[model samples]
Target: MMSSPSPTTAQASSTAVAKRIARTARLALEKKFAVVTAQIDRELESAEDVVIDCFYNADSRTSQLNKDDEYVHLLKLRSRQPFSLVKSIVLKDGEYEGHVALIMKQAFPFAFMKLNMEIRKHVYEYLFESEEKVIRIKTKTGGQKLPYAPGYNTYNRAAILAVSSEVRLEALPVMYDRKFCFESTSILMHFLLQICDGRIYLTDLNVESYVGSTARTSFYLLANCKRLRRIFFKHISSNEQPKTAIKNFWNDAQPWLTAASAGQGDPTAALKLLVFDRTAFHFRVKDPNSKSTSVKAWQLADHLVFVKGLKDKLMDARKV
Candidate 1:
């Protein structure tokens, strides 16, 4: 007869089974996360009207009561991969009484689409397992009580999607390869312009922050955004010569800018104004859809005259 298995053998078998069970459970949670996120994306695409009404319309039913809340802000997904970014928002009561919840309309099943903290942890583990610093949990402090799940009192968290955490502008992790993907610039711009208070006074000039070593990158990125109204670029350090680099960058990108402007019917139309200084750069656009009065042909000529002439003037002054 076969000898009965030893206790050590039985223990080993049990350990292996436990590991498999844990692995399977983890995978199941990840799959659920994938399905929910995919469904959210599909709903977003089909429900453009709902998105606008719920998020943008301040006079909408949801905003009617919260109008007095001064700290109203939109939450946005910040990701190096363009498609992975989810467009979502979080609104809080200025007095800090209620839960910080995701902004959603009644039409969408916010409860079903929302993710539990456990699932968010799993998703981040799957996608950014190597980069743990990117995702963070907000600690309760200053009399702010965050929402929590059952059986928890101190640290409460609900199925709310929170993507509006503040991130250092230029010091993104190395995983985000900006030059390889131009949309990265768009994502960063949206973070600075749309998600934030709609403007950034850039004091950091790291190449990664600008997405490239030239001003052309900023121009191309801004060309795609319609909501950004104004931005100020100032030199934080003397080592970084922004004015000279920007002039060269603009000249290289002018052909593409001209073509884009012509398509829009006004050369200065895509952007309202671009003011250059040896120490700073200022930009303004009245409205995304608004067009400039100057004709396309004349706008290009005028820009060349202004930009090139300004560059020459600065250079000549330095010689004296």
Candidate 2:
């Protein structure tokens, strides 16, 4: 019973409805795209942080990119830089990926290997050598329990050794030429173990010696230092039987002495100086079981005799 609508009006209404549906679809697609873009941005930021941390915080100079596949992909996409470039890259505040690319592009392009051997040696020495008279080696994680001299300067140039393998190989010898002073025999042993073959280049060393397996092991390792020129041993007294302490001293010392005496050249040819503390031959040990109120020191006569014997042995070894 109702009148039919005009064709033009119906066509117009249909067109309006179609336009509305299209607008809604467009808005929904836009919202979806916005969400995806934001997620991608967050991922990129996270990946950058990971890359920066790896570049700076890694314990060794090795690639740690396998930790995260996504970040690894991100890094690969960002840049195909060499490990040395990656290592030498340092970022400042507010800098990001674009800046890193710019830096990589602008950094010195001359190959280090292209330099003359003498020039390369000079560069290595400049970087690895410390102005400090003595470099004090400390444990990676420990309290500073040992007393250090106040006036003397100490340095830590070990970071250069971690730059790259090529750099390490060339710089190690220069680094080891320094006068290293350790707080204790344990620390000296640890240092020697850490350096591995680098010990062969060590020329000078100073250490406080305690009567223990650690000291013995340290001396045993010292035999590997075929180029050693001088060693200063500071005797540290501990609670043990006098005879046991003296025997431990001899046991710890015998290996290095025998090696030096048996050198390819003159006896004691490898060592320019062999120093010992003034009280090196003397020992004061307390018997835990003894109720004696006073501790007995080694007899001065026996101490002098031991000192003379050590001196005579050293003199005999030093004769050309």
lDDT of 1: 0.38
Expressed as tens digits, the lDDT of each residue in 1-320 for candidate 2 is 99988999999999999999999999999998666544432222334322321212234334356845533222221333333343345456565633433222312335877889899889877766555777777675556533333333345446667767987888888878879888788888888887788989999998876647688888888887877888987765634444555455656676787686674655544334576676554445546798554434455665555545554555664663
Worst lDDT 10-window in candidate 2: 49-58
TM-score of 1: 0.23
For model 2, the stretches where C-alpha displacement exceeds 4 angstroms are 1-77, 80-108, 140-166, 236-246, 267-272, 281-304, 307-320
Worst 10 residues of 1 by lDDT: 174-183
- Which ranges in model 1 have alpha carbons more than 4 Å from their true place? 1-215, 236-246, 251-265, 270-278, 281-320
lDDT per residue as tens, model 1, 1-320: 89988999999999999999999999999998666554432112224443332123233224233467654533233223223223345445565446454443333323422666566445433432223232221223356333211222233221122433322222122112111111223334333343232222222112222334444544544444333333323221222233554455455445434433444444444233332323332233344466643211223434455456544543443345
RMSD of 2: 20.4
The local distance difference test score of each candidate is 0.38, 0.64
